[model samples]
Target: MSAANSPDFPMFVSVAEARQMLAALLPALETEWVGVGQGYGRTLAQPLAALVSHPSATESALDGIACRAADTLGASASAPAHLQLTGESRAGVPFAGEVGPGQCIRIYTGAPMPAGADAIAPVEQLIDDGPDAVLVQRPASPADVRPEGGDFRAGEEVMPAGLRLTAPRLALAAALGHARLPVRRRLRVALLSTGDEVIEPGQPLLPGQVYDSNRIGLSAMLEECGCEVLPLGHAADSPGALQAAIDSIGGADLLLTSGGVSMGKYDFMRDLLIVQGRVSFWKVRMRPGGPALLGGWNGLPVFGLPGNPVSSLVVFHVIVRPALTGQPVQTLRLRAGTAFRGLPDKVAFWRANIVGGEVHDYGKQGSGVLRSLSEAGALVVVPEGGSVAAGDEVDVVLL
Candidate 1:
């Protein structure tokens, strides 16, 4: 028997242990090629290499006079070295002639370097001695020249596989002359929020009714994780309703259901998964998100999330996100701006606002408090039995 079911261990598991189980059971997603312009937010399936060297040849980095460094050796305002200007080079146009002794060529930014020239005398430092000749106020150095293939070389690896594409990555791919990028196809996730009290946002609210916020909120989160969301609507706290809803999830890669996973009498999803689903209920040792279960239903992976607004999103961020996106949870150490209570038995992930490198709690750290998660903008991590005094260092994960 698993430790989660052991009489000594009770009904919960450590976050570390749960993640191990999840990693071993999760399936790899499929991949496809997409236009480089449309590759934002997608994970790369293969490594990308630069097709051609940037600045394929030696070019000018500024609009200046290109002359041999030896020719500008004693050139200054009082005793300026004069050189004959052979021709002007700008962008695609290049001065085909070589810059001989006592001669210079006009070069613009990104223009190829003329033959026999190694230094650049910027226009601002030149005496403008007419179109045929110019006076140098200062000596030019070779540092002013932009060497060939300066930014990157051809055949060099630009990006490795499994990297999530961003705006900058897309720009790099386009600059590298790539037309398409091989990326993982967005996973199709089916979501259902369960509870008789939950109703759609537009509907009129009764005395005990709550708006159906999880369905829409979770969908947006899944999209940010690069998944394709399939909204299955909401279900009541009934076996038949949830069963029919699960049966209707056709072609979805994963299943997510909020509510009905706790130990309450109306927790039909917990009882249904125990009876029919391949995976059983397993709580995590964390406040607000301690009520979470994972397993498979009809060969489909299922994540049963808590109903409370903050709790539901916390579970998604700490667990379901990594399973779907293949990204590990990353946190940083920040000083606590104020005192935060500690849980003796479970780890506390407090919704706290970060200011000037310190973490501060955003109102009460309750499961049902949605504003805390919104206003805080980050989750401060306090380990089991570890309380934070003011200015104490704590781990935090920005949302």
Candidate 2:
């Protein structure tokens, strides 16, 4: 018998236990180089350092005259400091001449300060004195100058490995002189939804058949977790069909199946895994997703998620995501907007949204209610035997 079927093994494990168990079995994703512009949503494979310092020299942060801070000391609107406007500077065009005593340069945002200039006098705070002079009405300090290496310096590490490259991060890399980035390859998963009653949308539905909502929801969520989903569509509840689907998982890092994990006669995944595959764990001790399993077959990890759309999503968030990606689902603490209770001996994830600094649970936390998952921005966690009342603080996982 497989380990999951062993009497000494716990058929149902705690959420933390499930994660820890799976962690040891997962492999580190490989990495590759991709253009920086196409790196969005990809995880970095190595720490990246800036190649060159930004603003290589002292520059202006605003449209203003670059001046010696000492020149404007004690000056105000009533008694302004007057200086000769020797030259002008704009982005990528610097004034080549030096600013001597009683001299300043007209500069726009991001222009390097001319030699000997130590501050900026904003255009709004300066009086244009004809074509060759400016009057600064306020005191200026070195603080007004955007110093060299202010944003980042050469050789400074700006990004660490395993960080997902979002738009801002990609922009940062691009600004730091990176034309391409080394990012982890997206994990490819073969997804199959089992059940004779399940059909894809736009198909004619029979009396008992339903649209395959689980596949749609899980596919999108998997992509959000940075996995490339190879959707195999729905499979009939038969061993022959199931085995065929499993055989087609070639080249995929994982096989993700929805349904067929429960104990009913038609449920074949858990037993089939025990008989032909190595089952690490079969069930998680959590509400809405207790019927979940993780194991390996054909040298690829298999994650059997519950068929109910919400339960499938919850399982993915609570266990599969971090286990597969090595990235934690982000979490935050929010106050409960209304009272709620947890499962007697299991952890429960209630669909919720943050509003006015409080958690508003979407109505009905049922496994079948896909709408709850759709409308929620977060999931409020309640431990076993725990009860939350108005204003009660609880940890929630962001969706």
Candidate 3:
């Protein structure tokens, strides 16, 4: 169906409409119990709370002497305060006796502050006098010490559901005494690239044939989004071959294919799905990826991206990826380094490198120029009928 004629056939849709269709079609996956060690990059299935209070007991935050705050109230360089050293307290070893009015304990970082002591005078502010005495030239207050549960309290929520865990997040979970975490089950994606002229990489290419890169590129992007990819390899342009490939996607959560979605005699993907009236949208009203396709197959969601390398990647970034991650597209307004003329009929996304708030476009904007996309860090978005001049603020989508 042509975009101009398919009014009731659901031909071309705006970017926002495409996203809304994906949101309505896909939902969050099920949950699973995974060890914290294996939780990195996985989304949280449930809210994660602290299992126990961090630093459950009062502990010294630095290498210091633990003493009563009152004893150092008037301490100064000229009128230094002197206290008797009753004992020493190192991490994992507590002092045997309580600190009296004139007594202090030699303590190291992470050591428990002795009983009756309310301050930690760092060693930098103390002068050790023999084995039993120390002189303090400055006062240390309770502010210098870490109290019980200073980091996190038991049962306090530290991570909310749907959050992708990173290294820092995993560290936080570990500090909260978590051995395992509740995270979403890994998403399985069936990947395929269809074209009779497409050959596998590393194989000698014949005339009129190019190597298949969409499968590898899309699979890498999917893995980065925490998906387990089931590579269905390449499919020929014939209907029998495509049907075999489709049937091979046995248990995957979603089907993602590139090529053969446009309006051409050999564009079998669109025609096959259009016959069943399963295709929701056959085109996107966006540059570089106008031929993108979204549809359903045997109750599974399918995303058919354009054949061009850059178009496939861009459509994935703007459509399939966000749906898989359950994350909204984040747009930033940045200063443009050059003028950008918008397309009168479609939304345009130009490959550009953004550095320190300045957006510089890559020289070429061709959907076939994959090298241009490789050099870009973001996509400078130009709305239909909108133009942006140099130094003007424009919307940017980070790649």
Candidate 4:
């Protein structure tokens, strides 16, 4: 369907359609080698394989005496085994002598097993008689040993590409001897806030002037998605100012603007985008953010959100962020008691707080109130023309 006449135009692109558009428009960028410690939260650009064999050689897994399993099998708890302690082996140190029958070596955790050693009797299971000798209280078996390459063999694939490098994953890479990893380069995004009434925060409020919360909020959200946020500041309601702001942000991977995309007389963002870019869609069938714009400006994805505070955030989380991250969009069904009566035909996203397993709608559902959104844990999505009763389930998009 065409962008203008399509049933689900601009705002409410179907989940599949949105994902396909994102994939067709954006391609994975170049990769860079970063240290494993700095890889957390970044997606891997290439598969991370072991640089060398983990452990590099056979090693001990515990502090105890290392000996051949056959040497200790005959002895039992009733009649303890006796073996001469040849030498001590510590972590990162290798035993110099081979362990033969009736011979054992005192080994600590992580120490490499000596040649001919097949099992380890934990220190707790043995009694120390003197510095050179230790007595085993019970017979050890082959199961008591950690053989070579038991954890990981050489040239084994550890972590594959496209994986988000979390803390535990980074640690595993480090343990696998990966000092550096390949990660995707960060996407650069340009942000613009539109409207004559909006003023920068901390500035004295003149008549008809409101603080420019959208710019600040949208910038933080872009950065949270791992983008390099370039704040282009506020654009006046005039088309000249909007066009100037659009031209100034050159070579950005994505352009995000708030306000002036709706059907209002002062709305100029859609016109500006049509002139400089392709306007894919102008409006969506959704509440709180129905007047949204999606297009490509100068070969960069551009998203135009509503001027209201809550509406801007809702669209940002629902559409913009997921498009940038290439993450699949998921619709969650709200727990019982989240439905509202008299919901309209358009999909409505309202701020709600989850307490005691129930979602209570926050007061002041107006898009202008940022405080309501700040206190909300989720966005309760009411489908078109659907009315919900107490304890009825509804779809929710978690913020």
The TM-score values for the models, in the order shown, are 0.90, 0.95, 0.91, 0.77
Q: For residues 43-144, could you state the per-residue lDDT of candidate 3 as single tens digits?
A: 988888898987877999988899999999989988889999999898889897999998899999888888999998999889988889999998877887
Q: Best by TM-score, which number?
A: 2
lDDT of 2 by residue, 1-399 (tens): 433346644578998888887777766778899999889788999999999998688888888888888899999999999999888998888899998989998899888988999988888899888999988899865777888999999999988998888889999999889999999888888999999889879989989887998888788878877888898887899878888889877688888899988767787776677778767888898987998988888778888998877888899888988876788767898889987688788888888888998998777888888888768888999898887888899989988
| Model 3 alpha-carbon drift over 4 Å, by segment | 1-7, 73-80
lDDT of 1 by residue, 1-399 (tens): 232243432257776666666656666777799999889899999889999888778988888899998988987889998989889888888888898999998898889899999999888888888869999888977888898878888999988998888899898888788999999888888999999999999999999999988887898899999988898999999999999999999998788899988878888887787767766446888887898887788888888899998899988898788877788888998999998889998888889998898888886888888877777878888888889999899889888
Candidate 2's displacement at residue 246, Å, is: 0.3
Per-candidate Cα lDDT values, in order, are: 0.85, 0.85, 0.87, 0.77
Decide which is better by lDDT, 2 or 3: 3
Off by over 4 Å in 1: 1-10, 73-83, 123-127
User: What would the per-residue lDDT of candidate 4 be over residues 303-333, giving only the tens digit for each residue?
Assistant: 7888988888887787677777767546577
- Using lDDT, give the best candidate's number: 3
**Per model, how many backbone clashes are there?**
0, 0, 0, 3
Candidates 1 and 3 compared: the better one by TM-score is 3
Which stretch of 10 consecutive residues in model 3 shows the poorest summed lDDT?
1-10
